[model samples]
Target: MWLSRACLRLLIGSDVSEHEEAPLIWLIAGEPSGDLIGARLIEALNQQTGTRFRIAGIGGEAMASAGLKSYFPIADIAVMGLIEVIPKIPRIKRRMRETIAQIREDKPAMVVSIDVPGFCYDVWKGLRGSEIPLIHYVAPTVWAWRPDRAKKFAQELDHLMTLLPFEPPYFERVGLDCAFVGHPVLEGGADKGEGQRFREQYGIPPEDNAICVLPGSRSGELKRLGEVFRQAATTVAEKYPDAVFVFPTVSYLRVQVTELTKNWPGRTVVISSISEKFDAMQACDVAMAASGTVSLELAMARVPHIVAYRMNAFTVQIVKLLHGWNQNFVNLVNILLGREVVPEFIQEKCRGDLIGAYICKLLEDPATCEEQMRSVDSALAMLYPPNGLPSDAAASFVVALLGAQNQTNFDKR
Candidate 1:
């Protein structure tokens, strides 16, 4: 009987007295997107449990605003690309150890690792024998790159929360407990963006052809794909001489993206506000985007678009050697449909002329644009869940875990 009470106390912390030590949940989020998701999760937890938690972790401004006292800067760990990460290896390892040390000292009731799989995996391994329940918020792309990682996660993580509906099966087949919370993208406020407002603000003539280009939000992504996109815009302008190019970037990257566009061939505009970015996307006739979550947003906006991407040459070589071109598509939309609903220009094939050619074709062919938009509708329908919000779904899982522990304590008494 005492054993169960002790276990419950340890699992939930000093929940009886708010003046006593408040319960803590340690979170680790490595990038911007993860930070956004983590912030929402914290809000959900507070709402569902009806108890304020002392949240601490490594995160960006969004999580901090949501009430996390981040122990360190998230940018220190928000690294990507295999070869690009080479120089930051030592720092990453040090931060991993620091994170592990903090988790040990804090002894959080639960440790939630969000999205930065490689760094999170190492931290998970470091806490191998600890009693703290390890919940990983985004499953690794085991279905895409390495199938073996699923078995390792099944053995390590106590629970896996996934964004995609089809993801649970991949992990569950390997004995991992999995839940498909709806994707965060679906929860984006549908009423926020106004395309006509953006066009009016910019004084873009109604007859002018506009193309929105999302190079990517990451600095590294901007560095690799910016020139390619710029070249493509020039090619696009050649076909439609009065074409206006819009580069909607995250605020931090706005100056850099703006500087890059200076060399562009025709009229260009750069916007940083997210709502304004979406508004610009809505206003454009067609978009050429670097493949990422933004591709999903463009689809939801009902825009006909082409997806393009470029990477460090060495990274491209490594990807080719390991995965090859086996996965028929890179754009999330095409991947979801299991076919090329949109044109994909990748690596050496991501030529400006070719990308421009596809954009022109899509603009000229109404049938093709209609067909792709229809696919977008089908993909979105598959993604939306019948129940509550994604954050609420994730919160329900955590709440259930807490409830089970509380019940165990009662049974022992």
Candidate 2:
């Protein structure tokens, strides 16, 4: 309701330069992970259009590095969960309006919303019934939770770009032009890290155990899981006095993570850069992380790991009520393989003592660790696009949209 169909039609029909070399691509990414995807997509789009295509929208550090001047900081709308997001609803709505108004003004060739479904879907709805092509990267989890959203996505979006292989059929059957464009974790350089180099740089002894502790990127995640993860890591550290706890965090959270872990018995290293985090993953004997994309990254690094996450109590109950009857896993690796390849401690079970016990088991059992890593290789292999890298495959789909858009009856109208 932010923009009327009448207003959108007027904007789309306005005079646009045919001779302009730089076709504008307004891309929106509402979190760090999506920002990474946005950055790589910018690179791939550059390969297709070079500096001839201008990229702009909301993004974080990574996309900014890829030459995007965002209208606002991604944090303005980066909030997650039902209860946590309620307080920020007004602010997020304001930002969403700002984004819609900008799109109305800029009239970019295509608008691509990456990942954040709530924010992105609203912006797309505002421009609903317009000639402007709407594309969404990372299809919403309709296959797992709300199956009806697949129909909604097909109705609202001009094209759909999915990460999981089995996802395309869900939307494509609904008449949405959905493509399985690979997953970001596959080409993210998670597997290319040099463990020895990381160890040498950090001045850690070769024989010592290095454990990577990732609470999460968002402040909310840190608030929820930080202390629990700290306790779990502490429990593990007690067993191995020489264990080096490596906290791989974003720049803003570096000081907070350091301040929180100052009193720990074992040596601690806080690293902010992505390369350092990946290298730390390689250097790590095991990782205890909040559940999300990091598990896939750990799998890529062949690191033995356990996933833990705690959400608002009310949200937990709602999610449990909403989940499919047979849906058993919170971790992606487990979900894809249709079995528990990695251990997951969620809700009440996401405790320090319980997670620590599992961490201890992984550390003590080398064969178990090897088996989990081997299991993930099959899961990880399925994430790659049949033709090329994830970003490239996504770019090809978008470029095709440009051609199709020109031929559409809506544009001619």
Candidate of highest TM-score: 1
Q: In model 1, which runs have C-alpha deviations exceeding 4 angstroms?
A: 1-23, 81-87, 189-191, 312-317, 323-326
Candidate 1 least-lDDT 10 residues: 1-10
| Per-residue lDDT over 291-385 for candidate 2, one digit per residue giving the tens place of the 0 to 100 score | 99999989999999999898888876776588643368889999999999899999899999898888889889999999998899999989988
Worst 10 residues of 2 by lDDT: 1-10
Measured by TM-score, how close is model 2 to the native structure?
Answer: 0.85
Error of 2 at 374 (Å): 1.5
lDDT of each: 0.81, 0.84
Candidate 1 lDDT, tens digit per residue, 106-198? 998788889988899899999988888899998877667767788989888999998888789989998888988778887675325677888
Question: Model 1 — TM-score against the truth?
Answer: 0.88
Q: Evaluated with lDDT, which candidate comes out highest? A: 2
